[model samples]
Target: MSGLAILLLAAGASSRMAGRDKLSEEVDGQPLLSLMCRRAALTGLPVYVTVPSDAHPRTGLTGTATTVPVPDAAEGMAASIRRGIAALPANTEGVMIVPADMPDLETQDLMHVAAHFHGGDGPILRATSENGQAGHPVLFPKRSFDDLCELSGDQGARALLKRDKVQYIALPARHAITDLDTPEAWAAWRAANG
Candidate 1:
């Protein structure tokens, strides 16, 4: 895990949550952002969380995980990813990017992806549903960092995953596809799994 870093993306404005800040919302008595950061820490890998400057004070993320502030978070996910990537250590071999809204994303799923990342020229490992739908916590090798840095707008690294040269490991986990972006989605998740 020394070569791999976990970048927790928490910089979004949560526009679909009906004025609510999804990261501050509680799941099992813990804030969702804090829970995700803790889970990322469990792998013993370096964890960096990207939060909007305004949200940094209330994120409740400390300790081994570093908080990266994206002043232009409103620009979209690319801004957060750029900030996180820019903060990475020069020796980092890869990065696992996980969204803070994925409430059901388990530590085991992250560990599984991290464990599968071989150093040097390795494939992008993405968590997928049982039916092969790609999901969050995508692992990108150092070779792809440049491409990731060039991203703009709301686009993520999904475009990089489609490259013919890029190999892929599809980890099967139902929770990987579950994200609580809206109030209804959050309520539904809480109702089903709380």
Candidate 2:
């Protein structure tokens, strides 16, 4: 994890949650963004969280994680991904994209994905559910950095992921895909997890 950075994508509008902010939703007694940054930190990787702006409220909750301000946050996930990639350290050998809304992804889950990344020759590592459902916290090697930096719109890295050779790491249960975008989704998750 030393040469790798974790990008906690948190600049989305959460339009599906009505007027509520999904990243602000509580998980284990703290905001989801803060919890995710803390968990990513546990993996010993440099955590960079993308917020809507430098003054965005989520910026204050990122703790020790470096906050990457997304001035074009309205452009969607691609904007945050581009800025976050550009913000990574000059020597970073790999990067892990951890969507902040995935409240169930634990420190161990992240480590599992990072553990698969073996530097210069490492294939793109994508975390999947135990049952083989492809999902988040995807790790990309430095060779793919240019493509990531060229990303546009809300599509994220889907096109790149589809075209690249990826190795999947499975985490227990639904930890790899539990993204809570709506209030009902949050309620369902909290009720089940708590």
Candidate 3:
């Protein structure tokens, strides 16, 4: 119990990928979901991944990270968020919600967010690009867990982020905001980075 937990959101249908499973897509020779899970685990924080019932067998995630099946995942992103939040340990003073589709989000980036988390009294910590664009792996204090658990529909945590008392950490890496949702975006990312 490091006082913080990471909820890896992987339950989405990836509807825009044209039938391709983005989580199964490999980056640097490892599946995207597995890579994110492994990186979050390396930070020594409890990592819980929310995936659809059918996604567990293919995720290839083992060891430190726990896989939580979001049976109602098809309902929307809210379902996954609620499930993941409920699965967090009781001692979790804060949680970093990381989306599995962010290919450029590296292990160090996860560590950066974890390292910056203070405690329940601190403001929400969000990673931002050099240009001031807010990004994923947003750390929400325990104070906000109630609001998070109430999230509904496909909006995720955007509503929470808009509230006051949020702080941002600028990550030098440009990949903090890069999310591969479609085939073209995925191919473009590979061509640019690989």
How far does residue 28 in candidate 3 sit from its true spot (Å)? 1.0
Q: Which scores better on TM-score, 1 or 3?
A: 3
Per-residue alpha-carbon lDDT of candidate 1 for residues 143-184, written as tens digits (9 for 90 to 100)? 888988998999776577777354444556567788888999
Candidate order, lDDT descending: 2, 3, 1
**Model 1 lDDT-worst window of ten:** 164-173
RMSD of 3: 1.6
Tell me, by TM-score, which candidate is best: 2
lDDT string, candidate 2, 50-144, tens digits: 99998889998898999999999999899999999999889999999989999889999999888888894579999999899999989999999
Q: Which prediction has the highest lDDT against the true structure?
A: 2
lDDT of 3 by residue, 1-194 (tens): 36988889988898999998888899879888888888888888888988887446644653467888889988888899899889888888999998889987877888887788879878999999879899887999999989989989998889888974888988776767998999999989989986
Q: Which of candidates 1 and 3 reaches a greater lDDT?
A: 3
Residue ranges of candidate 1 with Cα displaced over 4 Å: 164-173
> lDDT, candidate 1, residue 143?
86
Better of 2 and 3 by TM-score: 2
Candidate 3: minimum summed lDDT over ten consecutive residues — where? 54-63
Give me the runs in candidate 3 sitting further than 4 Å from their true place.
54-56
Q: After superposition, how far is residue 137 of candidate 2 from its true place, in Å?
A: 0.7
How does each model score on TM-score? 0.93, 0.97, 0.94
